[model samples]
Target chain A: MAEKLLNWDEVLIGGTIKDPGNSKQYETGSWRVERPVWNPDTCIQCMFCWVYCPDSAIKVDENGKMAGIDYTFCKGCGICVEQCPSKPKSLKMILESQAKGKTEEELRKEVFSSEK
Target chain B: MGKKVALTGNEAAAHAIRQINPDVIAAFPITPSTPIPQTVAQFIADGEMDTELVTVESEHSAMSACIGAAAAGGRVMTATSANGYALMWEMLYIASGMRLPIVMAVVARALSSPLNIHGDHSDIMGGRDTGWIQLISENSQEAYDNIIQAVKIAENKNVMTPALVAQDGFNTSHTIEIWELEEDKKVKEFIGEYQPLYPMLNTDEPVTHGAWAPPNWYFEHKMNQLRGLLDAKDVVEKVGKEFGDVFGRHYGLYETYKLDDAEYVIVAAGSVCGTTKDVIDTLRENGVKAGLLKIRLFRPFPYKELADTLQSAKAIAVLDRVSPAGAQGGPLFTEIRSALYDTQTRAPIVNYTYGLGGRDTQPRHINSVFETLKRIVETGKVEKQFDCLNLRGEWR
Candidate 1:
């Protein structure tokens, strides 16, 4: 009976993992985003990149050149890359990886510890 | 002291309902709002909330049961979202017309087509003309407190209209947060025992309810409903003040964030207001002079307070999540424009339709909206209507 109860616990917790290709959880990545890249060569420094970044991902350095995105906060909507007014285009975006494997608690800790 | 726990918006709503100790809770399971009933059922089973949890098959039946329970002199509550709320359309109007004072939590979700289960104002906006008092909440904590306050406001003698407490479906409903749960004793003390004016199921004084009315008296009945809704404004403010005094959390009909000396202001409702506040902070830091006006009580439409608050701005951007079909503008924009029409002190108002069908409305989109508003103010060029931060070429 004890062994049966333990088996029941295992089934409730771990036995639900199915093949990723065939699972309904495949639909979980609907909110995924691609990472953005900046090209300072064609940059006009109009602050459009800074203004359009949804996640505050883009940063300006002390000298005011376009510092690369901080991937932690960037949801990669590519608004900065899409809205860049430079003819050659100062910013571009590409599909990267899904943001996973972090619990809410871990994210909160990371957010609080960042100022230090 | 009661224990504090990290609760989702749905859980917080369920916890608040438990605190109210409603005699009847009739609800159906619907996405973004299903967890509320489920959690409330668990509370019932755990003996924490001594109430009847009636499981109904459809949203229509759930609301019907609520009306029945309320008419029978039982304090009743229910919740639904999006498509489920759409299903309860007829009963929603009936509940208001009957002056049932039934309190419902509507977790606002997008209506169907592509079949999205995310958050939007489509559900609540669709029911805007149903004559129900609508209150929008920005976060889980607000969702919890608003439910308790809704019961008080709805059941007040001056206003016996049914109230719909709306929160963002998935964004606020499912997101977890630490909320201060009110003690049951205090809530019971604040919202006293439920009494019915004419309880249908009363054995000593039984009454026939929901009877048909002729045109002669039909208009009078509707006038009563209108009077009740208008009277709700005072009850809502009074109850909110009392609840705040007891719980240390005060709420107003609308809240202005950094609006003092602001050149441009964004008027928003529901959970997006939180994101709007963040963007307003960022814009103020950069000297953009943007501010936010969050509408809490949307029904009987707080026109005086809104006009007084927003009359000083150079330009106002009214962000609406729901669009009125075949109308000249979004629902909120039309109302705001009309509210400020007669006043000499008013600004050029712009309308922006965003986050329709649960499209993710991030802070950046809001910031871009402020940028657009600034341009409108600077150039003095009035754009008829703007769709902010939408995927390019998708509209065609």
Candidate 2:
């Protein structure tokens, strides 16, 4: 379980960081207005999104294979989509509202089917 | 008793530094204050001291270096004046915000617009809200003494805030004075080894300093910093009394001359208080109840003590040696008025801006202020409020 955010009095004096790199506990991906959808079939295992993402939102397996986007902390900046470097664009941006009511499987199938 | 010697304000401060022999000093050279770092460097060369002096390219870097060294748990210090101080503006907050107990010697000088390089309060007053303890001195002796005491005050566990000791730009910084120097062993005993609390370099403790805080934690950290500053008032007095016990020279938030049973008084700070005191002596001999209050600490202003001292006076004139610049009054006047608001004795106070850009202020100029205060008391009304002294022009 993630630790709750500490209020003013509970925090250390002089803003001294009691636990370094606690930014991981703060899930900022919910602030997204738009998110990039990736299609693994056409991705060619190029690792472009993983390299271009400002946030480490692109997921990679233990074997270093590109998996998918980690929406928990993505922030939906769409930097990977802008720098995909693929014909027909392996990565695409969709309004967060459009993807809201759809399941992850349905959204992935729909993103790939639309490109075809 | 300590040895007696004649040295300029800059040299006196350097002699204090030579005795303390701190771990590190990061400084840049600036006019009127350059001699301090220069003399310290000479001491280091002669093996008189063993401080690691980082000669930076600018005042900003100088302060930056001090912050870095201090955060790593070293006793740090530096010196600058005027424009050099303005350059260190941003880092001043960082140092204090990080709660590093760094000390600085700022030989006060005028801030520039038309380009003047002389003594004034502009440099120090400009940084009033930067969260540093400000100690102003009237002469070379006070300057030396204040710097020595500043070390203990800043390092106090309850009040670990950065401090700056200031002296008059040319009047005190350049002029030679007969100053008593304390024995080195006695001085070091008074300020023992500095054990920084939770320094970054403490490997076993595993501590962190100066991390970014979100809105949830920002307010409380700031309040804690303020608490530390407010708590310094007690520590300042305690250390001052202890210093007097060891060296035989006492200090407080301010020094008042002939204020007892006085009907009219002038409240001012810095070396100008000397001239005001001289005029007060003459005024008293001529049957005038004139007195002067010299401010020693500008930060955490001694509000209660000041109000109690000035409450019974019939009228007051606060002399500021800087431009008002569209404020209700000069900085000193604003603080005085605020401090006196809660007191029952409401002395009709007035402000007089004087000696800007290093103009000479004579005894007659100060006597005129006392005369104006005398008139206000007799008339029971403040007819004229804002005025200037020593300016070349006709007065109404």
Candidate 3:
């Protein structure tokens, strides 16, 4: 969501941000030219992507198993794909336009059909 | 009433600093201003003042440390001159932009290429656009008084802008003059306590200062800072008046000497104004209606008040102590001309570049300027709109 812009008088003096930990409010996904797609069917959850992601955009389930990638804060740096240790990589870097509006199963089929 | 004492300009500044006893002072020593920090350090060493003294390695680090300390909710100050001031050029903007309200005493000196260490306006004039309120002092007494008033002015909630009180290097900084030194208790009471706004040290209410403001926010923050600075003209007057009410030495946006019904006037600042006043007195005794408009609050330039004050003069000569550096005229010349632009004052204004690199300006030179103003008034024409005063071998 776009934050409301403040006029000169209403803005905080000296660019002071009163709210701490407010970087969460700024989404970095819009800056991404490439997106990271994940595959959970590799049957290994080394959590290496979670550990390597610079933006902390990786998500995990309650049982401490890798759930998926959180695209909202991902800047598409592809550090996770580079660090993926699986023989058939569970993460792949693809154009953001190619992944847009596509379901995960359809994307998995389209991206992995030519992989094997 | 304050007690009378003899002290140099640098000592006056140090005395004021000791009285204020700010929370922290980070400074790197430079010429003409070195004695200020030196004296303050002695005060601290002798247990006369308990302010934290941070002796930084360079002017850049000095200003950086000052900024850090000020953001941590401490009343901070420092002093520098010439190259040391030039070194802190970048941080000067940061201190004001963050609304740190750090007060500094600037013993104005020449910025060197040929390495002259004498007094001039090059240093302070270089900082005119750095968003700090500039209070120029005519002597050690004014320097002492301005430093005290600068604290209240900069720290005022309506202003929250850093201020630099400048006195001419060597000319005032080294000259001993008899002036009244107010009691420390009165000065402290006048400045009051420091109630910092949004201090970063307050863990209960964490605040981020100097935060990144991208394109969507940078303009507003800059405008806000400007508003605070522009609003400081009033705060300066108020504080100066309050200081006078308590201490008996009243100050204003600018000082006027025999300006009423004057046909000729000289607009100037710093210690040179003292010489000009002497010339004005001499000219007045000779049946010349000569006056002086001595600038005190330089930044926020007080365009309206200055214009109003200068409206009655028949002719005016503005003396700038720094090089124009390729500009049409010096900074003070440009500002005064612009200030008179919108007013009904059609007085013939002239610009003179003088005292550069600490060249001595004599009473005869000032008398020559007034004589030229008198000539302009009589003839209704100015032969040289821009000229150098007392230059060798004639400068047209």
Best by TM-score: 3
Candidate 3 docking classification: medium
Top model by lDDT, which number? Answer: 3
Candidate 3 residue lDDT tens string, B1-70: 5899999999999999999999999999999899999999999999999999999999999999999999
In angstroms, how far off is B301's CA in candidate 2?
1.2
Best by DockQ: 3
Give the per-residue lDDT of model 3 (tens digit) for A1-116: 56889999999877888898888998988899998788777738999999999998999899998888888899999999999999789888999899889997888778877666
Q: How does model 1 score on DockQ?
A: 0.00
True contacts kept of 1: 0.00
Ranking by lDDT: 3, 2, 1
Off by over 4 Å in 1: A1-116, B1-4, B394-396
Better of 2 and 3 by lDDT: 3
Candidate 2 local lDDT, B207-264, one digit each (tens): 6777776676677778788877877788888888899999999988788899978889
TM-score ranking, best first: 3, 2, 1
TM-scores of the candidates are 0.75, 0.89, 0.90
